[model samples]
Target: MPPCTTPNTTELVMIMDVESILHMKEGLGETSYSQNSSLQKKSTEAMKHFIIDSALAAYAFKTPEIFTIADLGCSSGINSLYLAEEIIKAIHERSRQLERLAPEFLVFLNDLPTNDFNAMFLSFPEFNMKFKAGIELQGGSAPSVYLAGIPGSFYSRLFPGNSLDFIYSCYSLHWLSQVPLGLLDSDCKPINKGNMYISNTSPPAVSLAYFKQFQKDFSLFLKSRSVELHFEGRIVILMLGRRTEDHSDKCTTVLWELLDQSLEIMVSQEIIDEEKVDAYNVPFYAPSAKEIKDEVHREGSFVIDCIQAYELSTSTGDPKEDARIISMAIRAIQESMISHHFGEAIIDTLFQIYSGLLSEFMVKEEIKSSHLLVILRKSC
Candidate 1:
């Protein structure tokens, strides 16, 4: 386990698998997938308006003393720095509006056991120095904000009850530990070609499996949040999925195609056995709004503040621009593979195919997809 210091929680020893760490490292560096700078930037901006500000208001921690934020799946990168800055700005505005002094902030950035905590903390030094003016950041006499990395499952309690004021996770949670075993046949054969996992030709079983796991995890997620959050806590989750529900035929989107093409290249190169590829599925599931709402309602603890999905506006740019966003999505997949799943050897092959396929998709007809962002408040 890796060493982690959470001021208000027990020390969590890092227990990430060595293979998984290597996979995460390789995946993040891949050109098409981990390389999407635009998506990262857009996501950062959206988070400010929808999550940071919304969570603070819901928690009623508007005073400087009341500003504390946590990013649940905070993979090591510049995203943490962006989150820190947004939180600080929010705290400042709230302080001035209420005429209260700025308070100290304790930002807890958490991820799975294998994530890069050292890198996460390394991204914090600049933010730390930037906030050194001693302007009360959270509501304390001296405005100081401390950053720490915590590695653990999001479904487990990692903080004292009512300790956090805000929480956010992006492009995560779609992944499950492993595809449910039942999807395959008695002979242990995939009922359909890898479609049961998450492709254009997805099987109902695949969707059901993904939903069940999501519900189970989300149930645990809500319970974990309930235990750690005070009444009126706020949570923001950004999940990936298709925008339209009316399509009759099963078809893989450009994003999925890029990954598929990469996997194909690996098969051609004998990096992975053709049989192994067919037998395996990417432990992921993209859910619809209704599915998400049902799960949240079933948990029965939070009020759904808002839910919206639309085609990415930036994706409409020139051919090069559209290709860039697809590349970003691929990078996200790469990060997942290396950071969590541990598939280092296939990284190079994965990117080679991904870059080629994504460019092809850019020139195709219209592609519109939606991401669901939900803001939830714990109902007392």
Candidate 2:
């Protein structure tokens, strides 16, 4: 997250063309996100109550006849509809209580341009059937659900002004728009060598660079979203985070450090290129709650309705079985980026190493994952 200059048209082409690399671009046959996404399922379920409650609060006012919603960073999977369905259920319940007609919903499922939109659109039939039945079961009037896939980076403009009533994002936002500049030396050699994210060995400049990038991308996110959302619209963002203010917290640190270790061993055995490892830095970060709140305040468009942090499990008791699933889940989201740099030839080997490393870490005592859930209401 280095200080990035405003890219010119041509530079922007290079800078913004990360869709080819930083996404879960796989289709449905194999290596799909849908197959490896149980962790995300747990993450979503953990946040369910907050999502439902937020919808209730936002709709307690005058519920619109044509309610518009967007799920930003909705990777190609049925999970994209999970929060949306919760919102729909809440709306139905409230409408039933008030003896009113439930409003029709227009949902925009957004992701990086390279995301598996085909898979998402393909799931619509089943989703629609469920949508119809769910409303009926709630004893409320059936509200039509319209689905559209918006392929673009949410860091920039997506929808028109005042177009969205609710915006929901989960397991995203931690992804920076692109890798930070200045991560490489003058010769384009890596500066933050041997680590994908901030590590204890990283220089202070590395963290500063990342911080600045998050600030810039998040500001753009707010500016665009503020314009797209109706007054009093609500958004809920759930992302992997850290409980402690320290950037060097161990809970968030172990995975990457172990990956670096595995890579180092591979380098010694000449199984992978050392220079490639040095040049690679992930476009992800686990920002502190203060970081999120500061950006929300600075953006000046949204009022914070609620902010809660939860500790999630990095273990599920079945260590050996959970290890493979968790590793594939990480690989599914990150394979594009890893393969682009490390080559697909080493992917299987690299993930095997990662899985072993992850298993070793998960079995340790009392590890808690820090997750932050923030709900915001667009100002009048």
Candidate 3:
């Protein structure tokens, strides 16, 4: 047989395909998503009460014998299972309060096809046992719970019409289905050069491109879920966002700016070419609350139940430790894209430089990320 072959970084970047390449770092290794996702877990914990309340509300709305739920962008980590268990427990407790039989649950765990599902599946046995033991302690009948992985992008349809009762997604919507095509010119050259994302120095067109992509992708998301959800089905989404309407706000772009600074350092040191840095642009966007509300209203499928803004500090009172933790967390999420774009050789050095930059920045200023919690009910 001929030797195996795969596309190179340049080839992949030229096409601007994110769905084919975007995935968190896999497995249980030191740099794995499972190891470095404490930041995400913190965000989830902060919103845990809202998540539980939303699940209960959905359960109360439709007491179906087989209650179906889906967690979109369920990356490989214990956090995914943790959220699932929370929903299951909330619905189970609500059934107990009503003195009625609990509904059998069908929990769908969804993510990109390249996600490390095997790593997630390996931990299910332990999760299931712990879940059952907890239910046994409460002295109630164990409701049947089933989980199956669905590998695909959420920008498209994932389920049959009127099949889902509830849906939950966290920290995943900021990623565009693909890098916005408007980022390129007629010559197919990157317009937002020397910056990995929307930045203070980027031109007006760059910000507009990012916003337009968000509008298109988010609208498609609502439309697809509208088809998949039962009437009045509920969705709880928590994702990275900004407090202001401006796309280049520091609250959202600081992390990417720091990463870009690190890449510039490498370019100055002649470790990587300047052109290489200029060619790369991150396929991510952090929207403002107003933007989200507008999109939901324009989509006309879901009525906004709640939309709130929250902040999570990336500080631990020690700048160095905070830098390490924050850099690791970002690496776990963005390494796949960065490595694919710049090659795997610079992974270690890049993050090391990033950590140092973050350390210095943290000592001068406290870094916090803004998040948006949106609860929508299918109304059309």
Quick one: best TM-score, which candidate? 3
Q: Which segments of candidate 1 are over 4 A away from where they belong?
A: 1-37, 59-66, 133-142, 244-252, 265-272, 313-325, 328-332, 335-345
Error of 2 at 58 (Å): 2.0
Error of 2 at 45 (Å): 0.9
lDDT of 3 by residue, 169-264 (tens): 988999988776566555556667889899989988789978998899999999999999998889999999999888888889999999999999
Q: For each candidate in the order shown, give its overall lDDT on alpha carbons.
A: 0.61, 0.80, 0.88
Error of 1 at 258 (Å): 3.5
Q: Tens-digit lDDT track for model 1 on 1-380?
A: 33222211100111222224322332345443224445655755765678766755753543436566788876665565676677676666666677777676778888777776776666566666655544454543435677777777786788888787777777666655444444554444555463324555766665565567667767788888876765677888887654555221123244665566667677787776665555445555566777778878988888889877644544566766676556555565455543233265665556656666766766775455466788888786
Model 3 off-target regions past 4 Å? 1-16, 185-188
| Reference-based TM-score of each model | 0.81, 0.92, 0.95
Error of 2 at 251 (Å): 2.1
Cα lDDT, model 1, residue 85: 70
lDDT of 2 by residue, 303-333 (tens): 9998877887757687766678767887888
Q: Rank the candidates by TM-score, best first.
A: 3, 2, 1
The candidate that wins on lDDT is 3
Alpha carbon lDDT at 50, candidate 2: 83
With candidate 1 superimposed using the best TM-score fit, by how many Å does residue 212's alpha carbon deviate from the native? 1.4
- Clashing pairs for model 2 are 1-209, 1-210, 2-209
Clash counts for all predictions: 25, 3, 0
Over the full model, what C-alpha lDDT does candidate 2 score relative to the true structure? 0.80
Q: What are the C-alpha RMSDs, in order, of all predicted structures?
A: 7.9, 3.3, 4.7
